[model samples]
Target: MRILNLLKIAFKAIVLNKMRTLLTMLGIIIGVASVIAMLAIGEGSKASIRETISAMGSNMVTVRPGADDRGPARGSGGDVQTLIYKDYEKIKEEVSLINYITPVVNGGGQVINGSNNWPSTIYGVNPDYLNIKVVGLQSGSMFTDAEVQSASKVVLLGQTVVDNVFPDEEPVGKMIRFNNIPFKVIGVLEEKGENTFGQDQDDVVIAPYTTVQKRILAIDYLNQIMASAVSEDDASEVVEQVTEILRSQHKLLDSEDDDFTVRSMEELISTFSSTSEMLTILLVAVASISLLIGGIGIMNIMYVSVKERTKEIGLRMAVGGKGSDILMQFLIEAILISITGGLLGVLLGLTATVFIENFLHWPTSVALYSIIVSFAVCAITGIFFGWYPAKKAAALDPITALRYE
Candidate 1:
């Protein structure tokens, strides 16, 4: 009646039906592996989004036209061209928390240089735009303030533009036309492949806001304004200051909502992280169905096991074997099966994560907590599902059991 002897007896019985035991473990193995892989992908995607946002400046803040609370009464989205040059000037003069700020405007058109052409966007910005974006140049220099003030047709090209427009030659000092307006290329931005949103960060041309506003779009209102706070910790304060300043500039009363939206990179990061976490939970839930099914399988097989071994149970009881020992033996067998499957599942999950990241080029970050959680769940499942059958076997009457055909 020793626990060790019970374990040996249970294990021997399981080994006698090796194929059935293996089949019963299949659902658990698949479930654990699925949970691990899904969580890894979710965590990795969250991390990637944060990294991408940080690269664009963790302390970056954006001021776009329109209130998010939109209606016929309030300002609309996207096309609400309320941001003006005067507002940009006031912020540059009033705000002390910002390290750099720039007014942004853009127009998309075909970029042509000699016999080659490619579709690209031309961004209208001042010299500080690069600083605000935390980007640097690969060659030459940014357009001077004089160029911006004079609406000089000077431009800076991103790597993607350079590759397509000036493939055979150095992009600096070359002449390119954007929407039929000729621009002197003064610099080439360092390569930035793509952002998390799948937008090509490099297929751009940077020019003075004056040039873009007057020459390409012929618009007076600013499209967007971007700024970098003194540090990441100061981003929220900067956002608050910018919001109040814009509200005052727009001359909106307390009851009247201002026509602008302010956002910080920190807020963006948190929003994305939350979204990824929700998606992870959903995927984990779906994968957990397999575990549920596996638990049911254990219960089903245990019931069959108890029925087949009834005669054995009666014989053991006749030899003075206690029902407690019988219950313990069956319970221990179920747990061993679950834990063994869980270990194999952990190994398979790690392998799957590696394959996904390396071969499929998907992101994957395996948290140690995931493995521990899966293992604990497996053990708990065995106990929960194995209890009823074990209890039934323990409650059987040896007298009637022995008299059975």
Candidate 2:
């Protein structure tokens, strides 16, 4: 009965100072909302990156030509012609950790179907390229190893390519001209969406590496080499082995630097995870400041509340209320205010997240942990900030408080 009466009085007091209560809660509202929003955005981005990387094969490593220090001081020299098919074949034969190896030479130009033309990147790779890239055919069949060896003018269309050139017709067995050269479309790749780097997965056309090297670009070297390890755990080992092999093939002495850079999916994932965790921490830290401000606001209003209600407290004390009761009442009022603000902030945060996701077309994933953390933070803020004022109110001398105006 006593607790209920005290809670009733606290509720009435808050009701009487509606404007002040709302203003005090404003900081908490913004803090909780921003924390939730930032966390959701960060989680979504991390998930998207992981998905894209996983799609490219979990145990894969890419080797791109780095500037040869022997030829270039920084970025001026070191010609683009570095890696060759021989290096790819050597890596395949020499590295036991390697499960698949493929060389890629890419060219970009207009792909034409009669009067219709679309700009797309054309990749030339072998049958092993599909395995290394983890690409799957949605329609028709991938070019066989024989076609790749024969340098056949056969191509595979990505989904976006299909939409652009053969919207209404089946692309398989259809011919598309690239740079006036006719190449038959043998297959279409399933849509893998965009990569984390914002490159469209569907806007690519793939052909035999030999064809792109000899017939189209007349290039004798590769743009990049992709290799998949026998197992994900062995990816680092495989990268080291491939790097050694490339270094040897390029005739780089031990004293010389590597002319290529080897990157593994594992390393990239770790870097992304570390970077994301840092960003999440930074965002939460900034949001916590708002919570602190809100706490201070609560403390200020609570002090004012205790002052304004001094006469009431004196009357209650004189009528038989103890110091602990006065302390409990004020503490309860502070907790109620915080909890109310927390509930409202949670709703506002979730609603704002939904709005941003829909309006901006960016993915957002709200985690249950975020809600739990926010509530805990709010509760703790209440106790910590409300302690001083509640203690002050409890220690008041009833006789002196009665004399207070």
Residue-wise C-alpha lDDT for candidate 2, range 265-368, written one tens digit per residue: 99978788788778778887887788788888888989998999999889989998899999988888888888788888888889988998999977788988
Clashing pairs in 2: none
Shift of residue 170 alpha carbon in model 1, Å:
1.5
TM-score of 2: 0.71
Q: Can you give the TM-score per candidate against the true fold? A: 0.70, 0.71
Q: What is the lDDT of candidate 1?
A: 0.88
Model number with the top TM-score: 2
Q: After superposing candidate 2, which stretches have Cα over 4 Å from the reference? A: 1-20, 38-60, 65-100, 105-122, 131-138, 144-154, 159-169, 174-184, 190-204, 208-223, 228-241, 248-252, 264-287, 318-321, 360-363
- The ten-residue window of minimal lDDT in model 1 covers 70-79
